[model samples]
Target: MKQRIVWILLGFMVFMSSVVMAAPAENAAPGSRIKDLLAEWRKGDVKPATGNRLPGKVGLVWQPRLDDATDMSEAERIDCINVVSPCWFRISSEDGTMSHAALSPDKDYVKKAQKKGYKVWALVSNSFDPDMTHRLLANPAGMKRAIDEIMQAVKKYDLDGINLDFENIEEEDRDALSGFISRLGTELHKENKTFSVDVTFPGGSPNWSLCYDRGAIAAAADYVMVMAYDEHPGGSKYAGSVASIGWVENGVQAMLREVPAEKLVLGMPLYSRIWKESDGVVEDVETLWMEDADRLVREKKLARVWDADAGQYYFEYQKNGQLCRVWQENARSIALKASLISKYDLAGAALWRRGFETADVWPVLAAELENSQR
Candidate 1:
């Protein structure tokens, strides 16, 4: 009888623990959908007003080698005037084996960017935290190890700073991520390297926000890059830009409540998404490259639809009797976003990637920022 009772108690304990772990995060604001939740949060105390600053110059980022190498050119790298080269990504806790495609400053294209006096920064990710974010929530040793490895990489490569891109972490890991970032900021400061984070558009459930502690994250890093796009894609039930104007404004406002305006970098998606209606196949995706966008307009007879609410463009047409949609970025939309930077007094803008920029984007950006003080 005693043995049976003990076994039952053990099982009960296990089940109870599972339930607790599975419960939604505490203080999760109500809303089933991403848009509603974000809207409601914006209505709350997340945003704070601010004094506007001088308009900022535009900064374009290039995610090189990883997406597709066939289209990348040598000349594109050497003389991308007025662009900032953001390294694709480097992973942590692993040995110093860089992936073949991820942009490495030691690599040819990066070297070219450096030679041309373009500003550069190293992008790194534990990316969803892997074992570190979970098992190391309170594990000082593991956190330190991750930090040490990353700082070493930054120094070895002579990077300007690091871009933190950890994503999809569990909620319990939020505090740990904040603690880790605090430590990382200290280390990066010792070497005069800036630290920044890549933030998802603020919405989603407690499940999604579990990994991100906006307050702590903002406090720890020099700047936070809000990826203000990717709201809807080809596979989604609807069509939209990742960051609609309202969404972008509210998200930035949320971050501004905790982070200084000068420390905030608004991320504009230079890419677009595509979805198949009948098949429910959606690709939350990139902008049609200059070459691809041109081919579609000039060669294909599809009509482009402009998303005024979202400040993006898309195409709707029938193929094989199935509806197809393609979302894209062009000189016009890019210019619109750049104008927002000036209007909002944002620190700077980061393009989702490099190389796919419309031929006219640079000229427009340059013209807009030509006389800016910053």
Candidate 2:
């Protein structure tokens, strides 16, 4: 009886080995190609993308210096150390006469990107002027012209598509805005181009300022990037880090109700805001990095505090003997945000700006995303 039992156990072990060997090696699941896209989507970086027809990877800017439009090439602008390809470059008009910090992406940039096989898109934006955007919304002819110019730019630049980034318009203009987007989508579709939009988190009804009529926007866009950060209450009083994890999750979940899961791109902030309290006055310290915060603490002997609710780190530093609380993103937060993307099966996430990422973000991103596939 013992010999028989030993033989059976050996047979079972052999069978298991055979099954493991026969199965395909662990492969990337759906949307794995866009895993790094999480880095770019959250920040609205608008860099080009590569890989299959998956969601975005990272969005990098290809803008040139205001004075010298020809200073840097697309390849030069990209932080290849942490980026995935088919990078999206921001398309802006540069005066041929004067040099602008923004890249003058004409046929040359597009041609170069296409040569390098980039998934390039023209980001049609009017965020620079909220007033102009408002005017464009009210004036049908103006909107039409704006759309036409965008289309023309698309053709001239040989772009993959267009990204609508008009901000701060009156609520009454929602319908008109919807109509404009609808037309843009239709036109882009005819040319086999994509239409994307940068939308704020729609935390359901009532809090309409922060939220949008997400349903309408989703319908109009081929891809919708949910600007999930900035939840920390700003203005008048000191607020914690923008887009605390708790706040971001609620916003993303709320947005999913109206937008298709695959079409949604989650946006995150790479930089942080610190609130300084001095002399009964609260001041904002915006866009500081984690390294800077750490150095100030260790080198400058600043006091530190962690916000449990926000899941972020902060430092209370004295610059010139002025007490200021500095808040910055950390590796933990990046990992958590990436995990959330996988949990929700989101298109991906993008950081607000490149070159501002925390020192630990990239390593954490690469490790967590790779492990998730397993």
Candidate 3:
């Protein structure tokens, strides 16, 4: 009888170990977590939650620096708007300052965009200058001056809103940063104008990502636009997709913890990165627009294969004694991302910058938007 009781206890211990091991780890990738959740859902171990299917709000960032030397014609601009059908256009028209701000809006482009039924919001940035951002956010006088200039520009340009794109700020200025956004949002709301902020993926390193107090800023702003690309940005030693589905999902989940889904916008990349590696070390990297990426694969006669793990098309070749790899972003990959917006009931999706996407993506996005409304 004693031997039998000891054996039973050992069996119970083994079963408990397996149960604990089967649970998802805290540091698991979003894709892994999703897979586990699906398994649980299949067994009816967990209840699935669904978000409301509201009409999706599409946004685009339009930077003048991306235009060609000859500039895009008004007709061309109108045609582009007709194709993408974005609800908001964040024009790169202003840069932040310590004493005052600079405003540069192309009246012609603004007039054309508004006539096409697009809400025009002036985008202000610190040009990713860390020092400038710290100064502007830290000093109370500087913040007031900057806000005054922004309001003046909004009135002068007859704009509908403002998009704050400040980057590379110091971690020490986190509180000040939130304060500035709060004040700006308060003033902008008074004028009946919308205010939005562009933030990077949460859970990043301290200085690079933790600079923005997402909870505070999201509470203050009308929309919190999360730049979900650059999972592997330029200058990184390793090479990977610009934004994999797993990385994006993880980012959205992280932000959702602090922000309401209605006030969140998931930013998508319309481009990919070409990494040049030699002997297992990445030597250089280049950005490729989706159209150009597709063309390159055909021109080089390289085989494109779907990477189930990354959830994107993969292509690699040897050039000049270096191994070149490209994680191509086509309609299919983007469509998957759009589906996430509906699944999470996010506010909407925003394209990184105008002009990098292929025409095929527009229809896919449109379908996703329609599906979301249902």
Top model by lDDT, which number?
3
Off by over 4 Å in 2: 1-103, 111-117, 128-130, 203-211, 233-236, 303-306, 367-374
The model with the greater lDDT, 2 or 3, is: 3
TM-score (C-alpha, index-matched) for candidate 2? 0.70
**How many steric overlaps does candidate 3 have?**
0
> How do the residues 1-374 of candidate 1 rate in per-residue lDDT, one tens digit apiece?
99999999999999976665555433233333333433332222322222222234436474654444422324444222434545555544333223322554564544555566654566765645455446544444445566777777676666666777777667655665676676677677777776777777556544354467776677667677877766663345565565566677777777677666676677776665545456664423334565576577667777777878767677776656566666567778777776666666666777767666666776776654443334
For residue 359, what is the lDDT in candidate 1? 66
Q: What overall lDDT, based on C-alpha atoms, would model 1 receive against the true structure?
A: 0.60
Model 1, C-alpha of 31: deviation from truth (Å): 39
Q: Is candidate 1 or 2 superior in lDDT?
A: 1
For model 1, where is the 10-residue window of minimal lDDT? Answer: 44-53
Per-residue lDDT for 1-374 in model 2, tens only? 99999999999999976665554322223243333322222222222222123334433322223223222224443322222122223223221011112444566756665555455665555544444545555444444556566677778667777656555555655555666666667677777777677778764222234324567667666678776666664563765677677888887888889897777777777767667667747765555666665666688776556677777776676665556765567777767776776677766555555445555676776665554434
Worst 10 residues of 2 by lDDT: 91-100
- Clashing residue pairs in candidate 3 are none
